[model samples]
Target: MTRTTHDTHPVQGPEDVSGEATTSRWQQVRATGDAGLATAEYAVATVAAVGFAGLLIAILKSDEVRELLLGIIRGALSVG
Candidate 1:
């Protein structure tokens, strides 16, 4: 009796016809689900920055803060 051996490679499915495996529709969708994450973060940051600017404007419009800032500038300029 004689024994014989054979070399075999992995089987490629339909999706692997191009020599690379392709992602399924579900996988593609899952991968793209976070595509808008950066946009959403930017929008939130913009809104928060606008709110902060409004607050700063309201504070600077007050007479006390305006006078304090002006006095500081005058003192700094008057130094020799």
Candidate 2:
């Protein structure tokens, strides 16, 4: 048995309908990449701020919580 493939046309925009202009493919790719980078930067900043708030709450409420957090920081810095 043999299989057949079909070719499809891009969507017709206002200019395309009039046969006046066609869109570039590379521009679509660059726009998508830039949007992805912007979203990632926003996410990182949100997570760091939340972690700091958890540390602050522990400091205000529990001495044990404060000691555990201090140990985490000390471990990270290899200090007493």
TM-score of every candidate: 0.55, 0.34
Per-residue lDDT of 33-62 in model 2, one digit per residue for the tens? 533347778899889999999988867688
lDDT tens digits, residue span 1-80, model 1: 21223222233445455522334534545654643458779999999999999999999999999999999999999968
The lDDT leader among the candidates is 1
Residue 38 displacement in candidate 1 (angstroms): 0.9
TM-score of 1: 0.55
Scored by CA lDDT, what does every candidate get? Answer: 0.67, 0.59
Worst 10 residues of 2 by lDDT: 1-10
Off by over 4 Å in 2: 1-37, 63-80
Total clashing residue pairs per candidate?
0, 0
